[model samples]
Target: MANIFTSSIGKKLIMSISGLFLILFLLVHLLANSAYLFGPEAFDLIIVIMGSPVVVAMVPVLAAGFAVHIAYALILNRMNMKARGAQRYEITHKGEADSWASKNMLILGLIVLGFLVFHLSHFWAKMQLPEFTGGHAENVNDLMHLTFGNPYIFVCYIVWFVALWFHLTHGFWSALQTIGMNNTKWISRLKGLSYIYATIVCGGFIVIAVTAFLRANGYIG
Candidate 1:
């Protein structure tokens, strides 16, 4: 077991599995957030369902999966950097050995992480944490509007989502590649699917942010 974890292939396998776990979580989370499109009542119903005892009990599990994913990524990245011995991040040419997204996963991941902090501050801090601490929970639909109402915050979210798009475009395919799904035919298919999936997944969040921003500014009915 120890040797398996310490081996490069094993570490990568861990990365692939944990990454896929997070991907599944993101899809489910995006679906839940989509309730806002139906209005405050529908969105609040989602919040109620998700906040139920059974779902709340799974929060720790989800957090642990995310933590494991992050830990493995950092460890693998550090090891790769050490092996490259300071040539780790130099992409000086358009035809560099790897795709731009492949070379900059760490930077993209960090940006996403930072934006998550910003996002959680606006929503989780205002809603979940308060409710957990015996304070009133804010309506999630209203929270979306409040968070995106500011043009600056709205722009920030769009930037963050773009970064997330790049991250997932690489990550989705890489995760599959790492797990032995890398035949030539499947390779092309995975790349195409990655873009489609990433766009759909990230697009969902972008639409919400854009809609909220426009609606708050009275740009639509």
Candidate 2:
């Protein structure tokens, strides 16, 4: 166990597991947020269900998973930087076949993380935080409209989604590959699956954002 924490492969394995966990969580989150498409009543019902004891119990677990993933990612990135030393840029260019996201995972991750803080301020702080603290939660649809309705915020979210899409494109298959799915037979298949999964998840969020913006501005409902 101690060796696992200290070894390179061990750290990667941990990162892979945590990344997969977050990927699963993202799908669940997307499904929950999709309820907004049905109507405010449906969205609120999903929110109420999310506030139930079972989901509430998992909040700390989710937080810990995010912490572990972010911490390990930073550690591995720093190690790679040191290993590359002055050759970092040159080495990055050498991987011509590598996806852009593969070469710049750290940058994409930082962008996603930065926007995530802004997102939490707009939504989670108003809804989850208040509910957790026994205060009245805001109307989910109203807040969604108000936040996504802003042209600036809407544009920022689109940027965030784009970054997230790139990040996921590489991270998804890489995580699986690290977890012993590196056989030639599986390699291409995994990459294909990664693209599909990333497209669906990010695409869903983009659609939701556009819908909220339109509804908020009286363009549609």
Candidate 3:
């Protein structure tokens, strides 16, 4: 069982499972945020529900999942580099075998993580962190509006989402492939599925952010 963490295949399996968890969280997050477009009341209800006792109890578990995913990613990358030795950069078909995203996954992950730090500083720090520390809660919608209204922040977020898109485009199918879906019969199908799923997840967030920026800037009503 310990080998599961130590072995290359096991590390990947763990990474894949954890990735799926984060992806599921993204879908739920978007669903809750979508309320902002239609009704502020609906969005507020989501904020309230997420802060309810039951949901609050689950936060630590969710955070641990994220920690495990990130830790294992770094560990696996180090292991791969060690296994390849100096020949790592000499592979002729590296792109063919892995594609651009697979080669760049670590770099993409770092960018996404950095943006997440910026994101939490803007949103979670103002809302959830305050409430957790017994401070008054701010209006979530208003906070979102204020952040997106800033031209600099709005552009930064758009760029962040583009980075996220590439990360997901590679991550979606890679997870499935790690979990025994990599037979030749399903390879092409999985790659196609990756793009479709990545598009929906990333595109949903991008559209919502863009709309918020426009609304905040008075370009839209």
Candidate 4:
């Protein structure tokens, strides 16, 4: 176990498992967030379920998965850089066959992480923390309305969703590849699967964000 943690293959395997876990969490989160499009009542009901003791207990597990994914990425990136040394700057791709998101995963991941912090501060902290601490807010919907009612937050959410889309595009397939699913037969299929999964997850969030913005702006009934 200790050797696995210290080996390159072990780290990749850990990252792959954590990535899959986070992806599953993203699916659940997207479903919860999409309830906002159904109106305030539906959204509040979803929030209540999310804040339930069972769901609340999984929050730390999800957070740990995210932390592990990011830490492994940073470590791998550093190792790659050191191995390349001065040649890193001189290397040029030959009209790369890989997707853009795959090549720039680290950059996109960082952007997604940055926006996640902003999101937690604006929404999660206000909604979940208060309840956990035995204090109370009037209602979750009130908090949602107040937060999304702001034009700046609405724009920030849009940007965050975009970054998330890019991150998921590469991550979905890469996770599978890392787990020994890279045979030629499955490679193309996995690429298509990645796009489909990324679209569903990112599209779900975009729908919620855009719809909330429109509703808050009086553009939607």
Candidate 5:
């Protein structure tokens, strides 16, 4: 088991599995967050359930998965850089077609990670940790209104979502390909599937954030 994780193939396998887990978690999280679009009452109820002991227990698990994913990303990127050495800049594929996101996954992932920290400070710290640490209870709707009410924060979130979309577009298919779904016949199909999946997930998040921002600005009902 230890040797498997230490090997390159094993690390890739771990990353693949962990990536899938995070994707699933994102879908569930997006669903929960989308409830906010229904209004404060519905959203608050969903938050209540999410804050329950069982859900709270899963927080560490989620955090661990995120940590592992980021760690592997850093390790793999450094290895690639070292292996490529001076040729990294000179090497270019002439006849190959690659998506913009495919070429810049690491950069996009870093942007997403940075925004995630900002997001956690604004929402998770105020809501979840407050209860655990005996601080004042955070009202879900109030937090949403306050956070999205700021034009700066709203723009920041929009930028984050854009990076997330790019990251997911490539990461989705790559995860599958890593797990042995890379047959010539299935490659194109998986790429298409990746785009669709990325669009839905990222689109859902962007809609919720933009809707809240619009509502806060009185631009929408």
Candidate 6:
């Protein structure tokens, strides 16, 4: 069991499992945010549910998952760099087609992590933090409107999602491959699935952001 954390393959396995877990987390998050499309009442209900005892209880678990994923990622990157010795510009690729995203996953992940902190400050802090602290939580729909209403914020979010798309496109399939899904037959299929999944998830967020902006500006009701 100790080897699971110390061995190279075990570390990769842990990272892959945690990565997949976070992918599922993103799907659930997207679905929850989708309620915003139905207007204030529906979104408010989601906020209530999210702040409920059960969901609130899961917060630490979710945070731990993110911590494990990020920690292992940094650890693996450091290990690779140490193994590379003097090679500074060359990046080792797994037995898949060399793509820009595959090589830059760490960079993309940092960007996503940065924006994720920014995102939590705007939404989670305002909506959930107050509830936890015995203060009044803001109206979910109004807050969404206010956050997305800014044209600059809207654009920045779009860019963040683009970085996320690239990260997902590579990370998704690579994680699967690390977990024994790699085979001659499944390789191409997994890659295709990665692209489709990334598109739908990121595209959904883009749609929500755009619609929120339009509604906030009174261009749509």
Give one digit per residue, the lDDT tens place, for model 2 in 1-221. Answer: 98678877788889889999999999999999999999899999999999898998898999899899999999887777777555443142223136778888899999999999898888888888987789988888899989998999999999999999998988888888788887768867888898999999999999999999999999996
Would you estimate the TM-scores of all the predictions?
0.91, 0.93, 0.92, 0.89, 0.92, 0.94
Residue 20, candidate 1: alpha-carbon lDDT: 92
What TM-score would you give candidate 6 relative to the actual structure? 0.94
lDDT of each: 0.81, 0.87, 0.81, 0.77, 0.82, 0.87
Mark the regions of model 5 whose C-alpha exceeds 4 Å error after superposition. 85-97
lDDT of 4 at 46: 88
Question: Candidate 2 or 5, higher TM-score?
Answer: 2
Residue 66 shift from truth in candidate 5, angstroms:
0.4
> Which residue window of length 10 is worst by lDDT in model 3?
88-97
Residue runs of model 2 more than 4 Å from their true location after superposition? 84-97
Task: Give the per-residue lDDT of model 1 (tens digit) for 1-221.
Answer: 99659987788789789899889889999999898777778888999998888887887898788788888889888877777644442231222246778888889999998888888788878777775799987877777777899988888889999999999988888888878886767867887898998999999999888888877777864
Task: List CA RMSD, all candidates.
Answer: 3.2, 2.7, 2.6, 3.2, 3.0, 2.3
Error of 4 at 60 (Å): 1.3
Judged by lDDT against the true structure, how good is candidate 4? Answer: 0.77
Question: Per-residue lDDT of 57-159 in model 4, one digit per residue for the tens?
Answer: 9888888999999999888667656765433311222221356776677888899899889878877787788877877645656666667778888788778
Q: After superposition, how far is residue 186 of candidate 1 from its true place, in Å?
A: 1.0
Best by lDDT: 6
Q: How high is the lDDT of residue 12 in model 1?
A: 77
Worst ten-residue run, lDDT, model 6?
86-95
Kindly provide the TM-score of model 2 when superposed on the true structure, using C-alpha atoms. Answer: 0.93
Q: Candidate 1 — what's its lDDT?
A: 0.81
In lDDT terms, how accurate is model 3? 0.81
Candidate 5 structure quality by residue, lDDT tens digits, 90-173:
122221135787667789989999999999998999999987899987788878778898999998998898899888877777
